[model samples]
Each structure stands twice: as structure tokens, then as C-alpha cells.
Target chain A: MVRMTSFIAGLSLLAVLLATGTPVQAQQYPPVGGRQFPLNQMSPPGTAAQWAINAGRVAPNYLQPVRVTLPQDGKVTFYESLERPVELAAPAQAALLVGRMYRLKVTGMEDFPGVEFFPSIELIDRLHPPQGREEDFPIDFEFTTEEFEWAANGRLITKVIYLEQPDRVPTELLERTPRITTIEPSRNVLAEADDLGRPMAIVRLGGRTPDPHRPEPSFFGPGGPIRLPAKVTQASAQQRPDAVNSR
Target chain B: MKYYFLALGTVVVVCVGCAMDGNQHLNKGEYHAPPAAMMGRPGPMVDGPGPGVLPMMGGMGGPGMGAPMGPGGMPFGAPPQRPAAPSTTQIRFVGPDGMQIGWLIPNGYAENQLVAPARYNFFQGGTYRLKINNIPGRDSLTLYPTLQVYPGHPNTEAYLTHNSVPLQLTEEDIEQVESNNFVTKVIYLPDARYQELAIANVETLVSTRLDPGVDPIQEADKRGTIMAVLRMGNMDLEMPGQTGKPMAGTEQGGIDQVAYSVDGAQNQFMPPLPIGPAGQGTPGIPGAMMVAGSGMPGAPISGVNMAAWGMPITGTPIGLNGPPHLPLGGPATLQSHTVRNRSKNEIPAGVKDMLIDVKHDPGYRLPPPVSYIQYTEKHPVYSPGELSMPAWAQGQQGQGQYCPPQQQQ
Candidate 1:
């Protein structure tokens, strides 16, 4: 019994030494301010290609849950709406393409269904026509089957990303770009129209009742400044030489 | 000057208040900060009011701390003593969620990577915080140094330092930092030796290199003077693959000419040059006309840039989708006016897709061919000779939307 206790104690001591001896990899670099990696979760499952992309092998990890890049942080929003479900079924079960560096979340769901997506690093290829913009390389995901039902009522499709995002370009092989993103509202509730003429997803619609508690709720109102009060302040003040003039 | 000092003094107090109390969460993704009371607990009366007044606790603007107020609302305190705002020095960690966050960065952590979102399920209700700050000190101190991080896969928890120079970390080391370059951490250890990786911003650098003799612009100018580059805003030339120098004495003056720079860090799709320099006066190639700049191909609003492209090569099948005569996954209809230069005389220069060298593609071992996108009166932007778009439905195409129909010879 005493020998057993001694062995156990020795093993415990060794374990503690190992734990304390080596500092965490995060220790090598400084802690990030305000930003946190959603590194805590096991990534969702998919094909070998998807796993390769998420595993930081073929590409950087793009399919972690709950990481947000904000508009204030050089982010842009590519939006589209579907009256129904959104389906990102690519050819040969390939990955769908999106346009933006986004931190996708289900902020507030209004009768929405499940969101299935594959954060394929393959889509992040720069050789494609629209290369540099991280925004233009949105990873494709699958949507719930009932997405078609929601298409009739104008579902919200929004992807907040970098302003310098790319557009719907060719498959990195040749030239030309489509102005509008295709949408099958039936497949994707927030999917935009496939006509290619409609670029931005439905951020707002005419005469839609908005949330009363929103700060500066004017999305497409007159002068269309999201923050009207800030606009008024700027308008009232004399423009300084260094004052920014953004729409 | 007087007002400035007063403002400075006021700022000092506020900055001190923020620095010392440790109440507000540090912007760097560190452990959640402790509560004010927890951070500054008042002890028993064994020492009779304790050391006359703790320096951090007695300062005005301190977090919920009680300081003796004086006449005119002055705290009558010594100049507020505050720890320096986190130096622009940084350490970065990419979390399991792929969110990049750090405590020290040129821009604070908020500007660098995404934060982990709140989770409602499987809440552990607990997380631990570790603070280790033994950095491998460099020869000189410079802020905002680029860190080439090497986050061990799966384990994801190892901090190390190796490059003697802060700017010499390998591309693989810096790969972890590509997405989240802003977040960093501040750690103070008993030992003074620091060993965390240092990364310098690619944009913050302007390393001198011999300009390659064969300028793409100069070559293209044979056809047309360099106009503008069609810089793609989406892609970037990250030189993470270029590491380790060739053997010494391999080039003139010991400079390795064989080295390749994953150049053009920004401006992805936009062309890199006009025809040649505008003075070269080389006419654009046939079928490649300088296009007018519009905006994102699909958006109604138009934006303009100086990237010059001949008429776009449109109406080709991008991928396989439907049968011949029908475009499957191709752009429904596009206008190519987004090209910066629109003058009919200006044949904007562009790289012909078939010939341009893949700068970073490791597999293809062939020298890049010099081909330009030319503007010809015939077959303007669209209308390819054969329906050769890769994945879409193949079919005879009418003239591209941006391309005007040509008159019959």
C-alpha cells in the first residue's frame, strides 16, 4: 500500500511538474485585446476538404463559431435576402462562395431555420479574379430545407465585412464579374435574387416597421445616415481641414 | 501650453485610474478583470488606516474608490502615478474558435481579430487566466514589431521565441497572425527575460530591394504605355512561403536575384500597371479596350479607381453547370465599365490569364509568359470564339454587355 501511494505521488508530482514546466503557447505571444478566439469548440464536421480548410492546413481556420469582426474595425457588410430558405449546394458538393470577412451569428432569429455552412479555404484562393478582398471570399454553408417557406416574406441576409471586399468574380481562372448575387429565396430565406443585378442583400425594405429600441434606426430613411445625430453634428460644425467626409 | 498641461494632467489621472484599478476588462483578450472591490479590498484595522493611503487607491478618478475630496474638488494628491498604457508591444493568440486576439498591438486588440461570442450551451462557468511575460529581449526596443507566431496544432498552447531579429520570423510562424494582427497581451513576470515572438506589420515595412529589370509595365508598354494597375482589393501577396535564404555568394554583391517576393500585399484584382508608363505611347492590344470604372459588378452605385483593364473577357462559362448554349454558374449579366480608364484610344493593359506567371504557386514550374489584355474593335468584352468557360453551360455568346456590337467587315 505504501509503495502504491509512493508511485501515485511520484506520478502526480511528475504531472504537476510537466504542467508547470511548459507555459501555454498563448504565453509566447501577448494576449489579444477585446478579441477572443472561439477556439474552445469542436468544429462542425464536413468533407475532407472542409476539415483541411478548418484545420489550418490547406487554409486558415474559417469555420469557428462566435467570432465577430465589426464594421468599425474595417469591416463591410454584403447583404441579400431570401423570402424562403437559402441553399448553398455547390456542384459536386463543392463549397459555395461568399463575399466578405464575416463573423456570422444568429443574433436574433425570427422564424429562421438551421444554418449549414462549410468554411472552405479553397474559396479563399487569391488566384481567382477577385483576389485580395477577404470579403469576397465568403465560405459557403448549407441552409435548412424549410428556407423556401420564408422566402415569400423577405428574409434578412447580411454579411458584415471589410469595405475592401471583393465582388462575385470568376472562379479565379479568368475575367468578368457579376454585379448581383443569385438568390433562390425558396432555398435560402435570406438569399438574394439570382438576377445578378441585385448586389446588396436586403438590409432594409420600404415601409417596414423597425425596432423601436434601435439606436438611430434610419436604415434607408431620408439622407440615409445610419447615425443621423452624428450627421447633424457634422453638418452644424464648420468642416475642418482634417474632418472626414464619408457618406 | 497651460491648457495643454492641464489636459495632460487630467488625462494622466484618468489614464492612471484605468491602468491601476484593473476593473475594466483589458482590451487584450486576457482573463476577465476582477471587480473593483475584489481588486482593492480594505484590510483590518491592525495597522490603523494602512500606510496613510495606497498610491493606486488614493488617486482621484479611481474606480469606485473613495479619495478625500479637497477644496475646488481637488483631491490634493501627488501627481497621479499610473502604469504606462499597454505598450504597442504585443503577443497574439488564435483561439480554438479561430478568433485572433492579443493584448499588445500597434492598434489595440479590438482592431485586430474577432472576439468569441457568448455561448448559451455547455457553459463551463469557469475559465483560468495565465500571465507570463518573459520575452526574449531584442537588441533594440521597437514598438509594433511584427510577430511570427507558431501556434502548435491541437495543443494550441506553447509560447516560444527564436528569431534574433524581431523582423526575421519565418512565414509559417507569422501565418497564425495573418488574420488577427492587432490583438496582443501584456504580461509581467518576476524574471526579466522576455521570449514571445515579435511580428512586424507588412504594411509598416518598406524594405529596399533592387527593382527587377523586367518590369511588367515596361514590357507591356511595347503595346501601350503603362496606364493604371487593376489592383484587386480582395487578395494579398503574403510572403509566408518565402523563408530561408539561398547559400552565400550566389549573386552580384551577395544579393540573391533568384529570390521571389510574394509582392503586391494589397490591391488584388485591379491591374498593377497602366499600359506601360503613360509616356511609352504603345497602343493597347486588339479586343482589350480601357474600360470605364463603375463599382462592384452587381451594385447599382458606381465607384471609380485607376485600375486599367482592356474590355473585360466576359461571357465565358466559369464552371460546369448546365448543357451547352446555356450558362450555368456564370454571372447572370455584367457590365465591365468598372475598369478605370475609359478612353477609346486608351487600351488599358491587363495580364492575359493564360500567360501570367503564378508568383506563389509552388507546383507549376514554368517561367511566366508576358501576355496583355488588348482592346480590339472586334469581339469587345464578351463573345468568345468558342464557349470555353470552365464550369458553366457552354453556348455561343452575344457581345458582352459592356462590349458594343462590332460592324461587319
Candidate 2:
């Protein structure tokens, strides 16, 4: 009888301990500030390749005016198709589709004799200029002398061109020369540019050129469509600065 | 039966007491339950005050005293700690144009010659006195400043690796310094939410520009991660008989005696050290070693007597011995060995068809590929008089200009 009573007391003690034990809940820390969403989850404003693939998802046929400025005298040739090429003088303006990537063959650069550069321009976003006056404030794709030298020396240079926010513009009068800031390669250029101002375009310059005889088709990319500006009349052309210089 | 009843009653009373105590603890608001997002998620947990325990009583097994009991008698662990900052940080001196920036070395002041738009890596978490001189168009004017570079934080990992902190003295800053007033500049990269502009740019908070009662450092902290702080005053650090001149063989005013030159010929500039969570190794820094194959082999199992007895080596073939001339070890004697299976089995009497059945639990479905595309293009229609062909297109054989058919009015 004494042994049975002691055994019953031990059984009740075990039951009490089991009932008092609580479930082990895991602990969690708050998400890092400004990183509520993972980077890959963000849409549209991403890498050049991502922008190219998803450019027309919102507006299929939006064209942004882009002006190509060379360091020196050079001709920019745009390919319409496999064999169709349209050549234009430097400081040329064209209507490029937003989100599409285009390639340009730059030749006759007085600085780099006998050398040609095939640079790519990716237009991820567009400008909203006044109606029919888009040419006045086209996105300037100027290739600086330093950038040209860097590209010629086999270094890959990626430049992100952005429009300055009106309110955040510096109070002092800045020079017409665009403010160019080079960041580390590991950092996301798109993200950095997006923080300062609206990124308009991305220009990638490398030393890769196509072969003369057996030129690769993919080197020219998909040859996205482009609309050239209307030809200038002979009377107006004569009044132009370049026309006068030619004379 | 009576003993069993007595034990059951004891357990019932204890459980009832625990329940009442838990209810009272919840009513007193001593315990704050974790957020819904944090609940059940595994991470670093912060211990809270135990039930019926006060924070002041932490010494007596209370909160922050190692696994404090939570509301339901659950023990919560301590919170996670922040990682240590890197030893060195690179600071870029952007320009006010023609201004010279120099920092104090060990023994003396490394004076002017480090012009604006130069970059140098400095030891982090140290306050260094600086001399600013040679201001363009402002001769005979100089300002002494102190720069404090804080350690890196988790929030600044990406920003510090990819971007350099830009320090520039604007015209207003110079004017303020000339007025014999103290100026405090806080250089920081604002958080994404606090960033007003689309492009990320380094922002500076000037003490003179802000409201009188506002603290620039505090405001900058609320806005973004602060990289460095510069406090400038009109005080002349290089006064005659002062501790600015180079002291030979002796430490002057707690500064080291080493001299650093701006040209970096005497003492090379400290390269920027990679920091933050990236774990990127610097160009010249060594990192963890990587072995190529399966690593080195273990010691041989054969005994020493095997060499003296002329026994075949472990790697030798089972029946082959080493070269007859050499006793210890040489090339194996076995040359060629082959294995073949000659046994065959009879074919079954009748075996012809084979069938397989596969069923997907969730069937794969896809939209049919696009078959037809309709494109409509709009272009300006020119009249016959207005239509003109370019010189290059006019001479081509099939490129002659033809006017489009006129549309009905």
C-alpha cells in the first residue's frame, strides 16, 4: 500500500510538469530599414537586360528622342535591318524606342585613326518635353574625351545619364558640362542614379568591334526600329553652322 | 484511491495558481508580445522581464539576466549584437576648387599640397585635426578643422563599398569660416525613404544653415547614415611657437613624430580597405587558401619490414612484384590484364509490347503560342507636289518615287 501511494504521487508530478511546459516560440528581428522588399522583387527599374525584356509591357511603341555627340569628327551609322544602314553626322538626333537597346557604329574618329567602336545605348526611360519640341531637349548622349580614351584602352565604361530634379538642382549656376560621377563597379549604377534623379538612358562603351568580312549578326543586336529626323531643306541647310563650316 | 485523489488535487491547485498569475501579469502590461510578423520566425530574440518581475530586479534573475522567463514561462534569449566596423575608410575630398586639404600626421602637421578632388584612406573611428588653406581668391585666410570618421554600420554596407563620401567646402561655408564663426558639416548618405531625389547623391547638413536650435548631427542621423563629420573654426593651428611644426625625435602634443608627404613618395597613401558585408578582398590582401584536388594523402600503411623483405608495395597489383633488380620499390611487373563475361541467357518465349502510364498531380498548362499579329502604321501622306525623292534614292533602279493613290474626300 505504501509503494502504490508513492507511485501515484510521482505520476501526478510528471503530469503537472508536462502541463506547465510552454511551446518554444521562435524569435524574429525587424527587417532592415529601406529594404522592406528584396531587391529582385522590385520591378521595371532594374538592369539594362531586364529593362530591354520588359520595356514595352506598359507602352509598346514609345519613342524617346536621343542625340549622339562624339568627342571629335565621327559618323554614327544605325542599321535598320541586315543590309540597310543609315549614316548621319555627329550630334545626330533619332527617335529610339524606350526599353529597347540599339547599337551604333562610330567611324572616322579623328583621334583614333583606323579604329572603329561599336557602342550600345539602352534607353530605359524617356523625357517629357513640350509638345513637338522634343528635339530641343533631347537626351544628350555625349561621349567625353576621357570616356573615349578609356574605351579605346579596352576598359568597359558604363555611364548612366539622369535628369536632375528641379527642386534638388544646385543653387549655384553650374557649367553646361554635365556632372559625371563614376561609382565602384560592384555598386548598382541604376540604383545609384535613381536615387539622385530620374535615369534617362544607359550607355555602355567597350572596345569590341565586328569583323569586316565575317561580321557577327548578334553584334548588331536585334536592330530595333528607329525613325530619323526629316531631312533639312537646302535653303535652311545652307544657314546651318555645319553647312557654313563645310563651305 | 485516496492517495491518487490527493495527488490530483495538488496538481490542480498548482496549475490554477499558474494560470491566475499569468492573467495578472498580462493585465499589468509588463510583457509586450512580439509583432505578428516576428512571431514564430526564427531569429535573434530579446529577453523581456519575466512574469511578476521588474526590470530593476534584473540582478535577481530578471530581464537581460540570461533566458528570462516570458509570459507563459518561456525563456527568451538575448538580442543580437551589431558587427564590428572596418579598420580603414576611404574619404574623397571633393572641391571648392584650388583649396588645399591636409591632415595631422604622427609628429607634425602634413600641411598643404593635398588639393581638392583627391582621395585618401584614413583609419576609422579616429578624430584627426585638419588644416584648410590656399583658398582660391581668398589669400591670407585659413581655417583649422577636425574630422571625425565614424565606424561602419550594417545599413551603410552597400553605400560605403560602391560610393565614396564626398567632402566639399562651398562658398557659403568659406564665408562663414571667414566671419570667425564655427561651422559643422555632416556628410551622410540618406536612407532610401528619406532620399527626395531620384538619383542618389551625398547630402551635407551645415550647422550654420540649419535653424538655431536644431542639431545638425541629430538631424542627419534621422535622415541617413552619417559617413564623416567636419567641424571647422577660424582658430589658427599653426601659430608661432605652437605644436604645428615638425618635432624631431620627440612626440609633440600627443601627435606622432612620423612625417607624411602629399606626393606619397615618403609615405605611400593608405589604400582603401574593403569593408561591410560584401567580404570582398582587396587587390593586394591575402584571403583564405583553397586546395586544388583531394588534398595530401595519408601516411602509408605498409610496415618498415615490407621494404627490407622486398614485399610488393600497396599500390602494386595483387600477383605482380616490383622490378627483380631493385628490392624496395620500382615499376610494377604486370603489363596487361583484361576481364570478359561469356555467360549468356536464353530469350523469353513471347515478349513484345511495353507500356508506361504517367500521371501528373498538378497538370502543366500553357497558353497557345501567338499565331497572327496585325500591325497598323500611321505616317504623314504627302501630295504629289510635296513628295520629293532624295538624291541617293532617286538614282536607284527600283527606288523611283511614285505618289500614293489619293484617298476619297
* Whole-model lDDT values for every prediction: 0.24, 0.56
Chain A TM-score, each candidate: 0.20, 0.71
Minimum summed lDDT over a 10-residue window in model 1 chain A is located at A219-228
**Highest lDDT: which candidate?**
2
lDDT of 2: 0.56
Best by DockQ: 2
Off by over 4 Å in 2: A1-36, A39-247, B1-88, B243-409
Instruction: Quote each prediction's TM-score.
Output: 0.15, 0.33
Maximum-TM-score candidate: 2
DockQ of each: 0.01, 0.06
Residues B287-394 of candidate 2: C-alpha lDDT, one tens digit per residue: 433322222222223453135455645433435543444335776555644434465868677867865454322122233489999999999898665655442343
Judge candidate 2 at residue B132 and give its lDDT.
77
lDDT of 2 by residue, A1-247 (tens): 7577768678767766766664432211112322121121111112343333333332424567788998898888765334545567897777765655567788888888887777767676778875556756678888988777766554456678888887888857355677788765434556567667877777776554553323345445544456556553233344542321110
User: Which portions of model 1 miss their true places by more than 4 Å?
Assistant: A1-102, A106-108, A112-123, A126-142, A145-247, B1-409
lDDT of 1 by residue, B1-409 (tens): 4544544455555546544543233442344321111122223211112332222222113211133434432333432222111101112221233232222211111122222211111001111121111112321211233222221111111001100001222232233234343222211111101212111111111111114354433333232211122111112221223234443454445644343322112211111111112122234622212222244232233223432455343333533333243257885553332324344685678866654332311111232386877876765364545333422112224232222223211
